[model samples]
Target: MVSDFRKKKLLHVFTSFFDRNGSGSIDKKDFELAIENISKLRGWSSGDAKYVETQSALLKIWEALQSRADSDKDGEISVDEWISMWDEFAKNPSAPLEWQNLYSKFIFNLEDASGDGVIDGEEFSSVYESFGLSKSDALVAFKKMSKGKGQVSWSEFQELWKEYFTTEDVAAPGNFIFGKTSF
Candidate 1:
């Protein structure tokens, strides 16, 4: 069962990220918008190799999510459907989540603007700012998640990613991975 706290956090993700079109559900259009927004953030113009690659990756992610979460085969994932799929995953945190791993890699790559294999504060803040979060708030989140290390490596990000999905503790730094969430 998904704890109420976990559900709140998941709902935050749905509203803040997944439901990009604000249509009360996640669909292909939402992923399309995400691709556009993220590519724009990276300054990848249409027809650019990077833009095309990102579009492919994001569309794959959308397919995976739709296959797993759109239980009614309605070509959309409602909040209830989204929560239900996550609830199942919550039962076995150790289970491999391929789509999630792919998504995490995508985010990590996006944040690692320098391509130096890590995300520095400036890079992190810039990506979050594209998501409509304030740079100051993103820096605060980066500070907490990085534990004052001044940067985050892929391994550290993976752990934080897992914590964000599995931890019930409100104070967990992973709670701010996507920005500040109302507890």
Candidate 2:
């Protein structure tokens, strides 16, 4: 079961990223908006390879989320439904679900703009800035997340990603992964 603190963290992600249309639920339209926003942030014009790849990745995420979380089959995932889905995953933290792995990989790839298999401070800040977080906050968060290492490798990011979803420790560096969450 997800604790209150973890639920708060999950809710932050839902509101901040998934519910892009402010429609009170997650649906295909929200993913579409995310694709547009992220592609625009990366300066990937329409028909560009990057744009097409992003479209494919995000749509796959949406499909996975909808199939797993939309319990009512309403073509949208309510906050309660989202929490419920995560609760099941939290029951076995050692085995992450497919969508979780996919989402993490997507985020890592998105943030690793240099294609160097690691995310530097600038790359981290730029991606979060696109999510509407301030660059200063992102840098601070990255510093915490990287433990002053100046960059985060894929293995490190995967651990932080898992910690973000599973740990209730307010002081965990993973808490800052999305940039200065109130929780």
> In lDDT terms, which candidate is top?
2
lDDT scores of the candidates, listed in order: 0.86, 0.88
Q: Give the per-residue lDDT digits (tens) of candidate 1, residues 1-183.
A: 788999888998898788998999999999999999998998899899999999999999899888888899999999999889777776776684677777889888989999999998899989888888889988888888887788889988888888888889887877777765345
Lowest summed-lDDT stretch of 10 residues in model 2?
174-183
Model 2 spans with C-alpha error above 4 angstroms: none
lDDT tens per residue, model 2, 15-95: 988999999999999999999999899999879999999999999988888888889999999999989887887677779
* lDDT of model 1, residue 49: 94
TM-score of 2: 0.95
TM-score of each: 0.94, 0.95
* Model 2 / residue 94 / CA error / Å: 2.4
> How accurate locally is residue 52 in candidate 2, as Cα lDDT from 0 to 100?
98
